[model samples]
Target: MSLRDMNCTFSPAALDAPDVASLLAELDGWAISGARLERRFALRDYHETIAFVNALAWMTHQQDHHPDLLVTYNSCTVSYCTHSAGGSLTNNDFICAAKADALYAQRAGA
Candidate 1:
C-alpha cells in the first residue's frame, strides 16, 4: 500500500493489539530513537546520498513536517519526531518512516 500522505493529526494510541507485533517487525532495524523513528542509510557515494536526502526533504516538505537529518559523505541518518507531542511517538513518525523505506526500496530495486 502507498504510504499515508494525509496530515496525520491523530495522537499515538496503542495500535490494535494484534497489529503491533507486525508493525514492530516491519520497523525492526529502524527503531524508536528519542520521540521518533530513526534509520540510517548508506549510499553509493556523496552524490547518491545527497540525492536521497533531497528526495526525503521534498517528501517532508510535502507532508508539512520535517525530520532531523544528518547527512555525511555517503550516509544519511534520519530521525522523525513531533515536537508538539512532547517526547512521544506518533502515527506521523511511522508514516514518514514507511515512506522512507519505500523510497529506499524503489531506489535499490529490492
Candidate 2:
C-alpha cells in the first residue's frame, strides 16, 4: 500500500491514545510488538540488521521523529513512541514503521 493509504489508517491525535491489543495482534507475525502502534522489529543477521537500522535512522531524520533503537550482533529492535506526546504512539510512528517495513522488504528481496 502507498504511504497515503497507510496514513489514512491513523490520525496524529488517535495514535497518542491508548493502544488496542487486538489491532497489534494483526502484526504479530511481522516481528512487531506492543499496542497503540508501539512495535519492534527483529532481523536475522548483524550486517543485514545494521543496514536496516541505518536506513531507519535516515528515514527518522527526514521525518524529524525518532524511535528507540536497540542493536545486537544479529538482531535489532525498534520501539516507536512519540516523545512529544509523553512516550506514546503517533501517526508519525506508524508512518515510520511502514517505511521501515518497506526497507526490510527491499533488503530481503535483494
Best candidate, lDDT: 1
Candidate 2 lDDT by residue in tens digits, 1-110: 54423642323554423353333443433333554344456677788888888988887787777778778877666777666666555566666666767776787646
Query: What would the per-residue lDDT of candidate 1 be over residues 15-92, giving only the tens digit for each residue?
Result: 443453455466646876544578998888888888888888888887766789999998899988676667455667
- Candidate 1: the clashing residue pairs are none
- For all candidates, the clash counts are 0, 1
- Candidate 1's clash total is 0
Best by TM-score: 1
List candidate 1 segments past 4 Å from native: 1-7, 10-22, 108-110
The C-alpha local distance difference test score for the whole of candidate 1 amounts to 0.71
